[model samples]
Target: MLELQDAFARKFHYLRLSVTDVCNFRCQYCLPDGYRPDGRKSFLTLDEIRHITRAFAAMGTNKVRITGGEPSMRRDFTDIIEAVASTPGIRKVATTTNGYRMAERVADWRSAGLDAINVSLDSLDPRMFHQITGQNRFHEVMAGIDAAFTAGFEQVKVNTVLMRGLNDGELGEFLAWIKSSPIQLRFIELMQTGEMDELFERHHVRGAAIKEKLLEAGWQQRVRAHNDGPAEVFWHADYVGEIGLIMPYAQDFCASCNRLRVSALGKLHLCLFGEYGVDLRDLLQSPGQQAALQRRLREALADKKATHFLHQGHSGMTPHLASIGG
Candidate 1:
């Protein structure tokens, strides 16, 4: 079977496919101004998504993560999940959401063949959650998590972006909540994107501090899976759940990259901070274009850099994480 291999010999088995760029949240770090329409073309159609997934599966891709400004915002979100899950070689179908309608809709998504889910829950405090996300649906989102386990999900991952003067002091609260909740709470280091440089400077917190605290309390790091995301997970004997840290600024951060990304606009992004992307929408118009799509993907891999230039303060074309489903 053929695999998508880059010049650095990194084999891509996971694909983060953004279905839409429309999000309703006004998270402080990502979209404090809320989602504004740039009037770009419509996102990939259902047929286009099917063709794209089939082409990727044919090239030995086994996992597909549906991402977006908020993927569930699409009326056809469940249909999209079913389409990817049914692909011949695709084995895992996952999505990242903000849990807006999760309480009311997760069971339906689970029934549609979604294998895993990651929710953006920045703060466990209801008032703090509101302050951070610019929304008052904190209780609703928490209930949505309960709905996930009730719907048969084994583990539900939560993404929390760590910041200095905001929710950074709640690490102990988070650890206590996950002690028996079966949640894989991930603490992501606040990254410097193009538009949020000022905010990044004001709130950026190093994940190493939290790591040190965990180590002092007896947390042990675990080996990462071949297709897992870039999280350094740690487990503790007293807790039923685990903790993961995503420190993008760490040296050799991209050395173990085994995934690729395709923006909702049908362009393939070689790196999250890549300068540009290659258009794949043209080849996704028909079923007969699979072979050509595979060839294009292979050609595009050669353009991926050995590592991103973020350490040098170059954010490339990414103005914000919501634009490309970061």
Candidate 2:
């Protein structure tokens, strides 16, 4: 049986897997100028990722999310999705993408039994979007989102990382757009990681400020809560879909964090803000290491910190969100 941690009674079963550390767009917050990995390394093969995921599923993991620098960038993304979706014990198979190439692959993704999609769309304004993501393919992302809807993705969640001076002014505009769309919009508080210091200096918007802005704009917050994730969700009375706030900085969710992260290289990260991870690639390579993998996983979970100190004003502590499977 999977042992439960005392810090948080919730049995840990969810895992976020990063398919690759390479992303098409260099978002300012995620990858600032002059940033590079220590050295070039090979990404986990499709078969390798599948093997580790299947082991985790067998060990009682039910939820799995495929993330990346951009999961869509992988040529065999659909194949990976199908493998995880077909896993017996896996209950949820989702992916977080920049949506640049989703339009062309939405149908393939949906047909592969992928559960849902979470697209990172920080701003709707073309120029602003380009400024934030450093990509001229904003239109492509929008089209991809439409394609996902057409492909019948059950719950298309839009993840917007809010920064104070950067896109905070557009919160109302985003909410207005969400009001008209069926997709759920989630506003995430800017945390101190990645190019966080510089990004924070440039944009770092807080959750409290966002909530105040919403309340002042005549948007009444409905009390209906959804999901066991970190996001504190609320609905607008006039809209069919709801808005969510993931306050990782203001109010930490580490205590109730049931998610674990697996990097593209096969390292397992217990928390989003954690500084270290355990390498599972070697274990996966050896049949004799199967039992060892489970034991290591449990050890990582037990060592999971109650909360991250990023909110407490730390630097160079955790890996970039993109590299760590944001």
Q: What are the lDDT figures for the candidates, one per model? A: 0.94, 0.78
What's the residue-level lDDT of 108 in candidate 1? 96
Best-performing candidate as measured by TM-score: 1
The numbered model that scores best in lDDT is 1
Number of backbone collisions per candidate? 0, 2
Q: Model 1 has how many clashing residue pairs? A: 0
For model 2, state the Cα shift of residue 305 in Å: 1.3
lDDT of 1: 0.94
Q: Model 1: runs farther than 4 Å from truth? A: none
C-alpha TM-scores of all predictions: 0.99, 0.91
Per-residue CA lDDT of model 1 for 96-128, tens digit only, reads 999989999999999999999999999988999
Tens-place lDDT digits, model 2, residues 1-326: 56434256656677788998878787877875523655768888987877778778877778788998888778999999998999888888888898988889889998997888889998989998988888888899899999998998756899998877778788668867878788789898777775467667667777877778667765565553222457766766787667788887665466567777889989987777777778888887754576788778777776777777775676334657787787
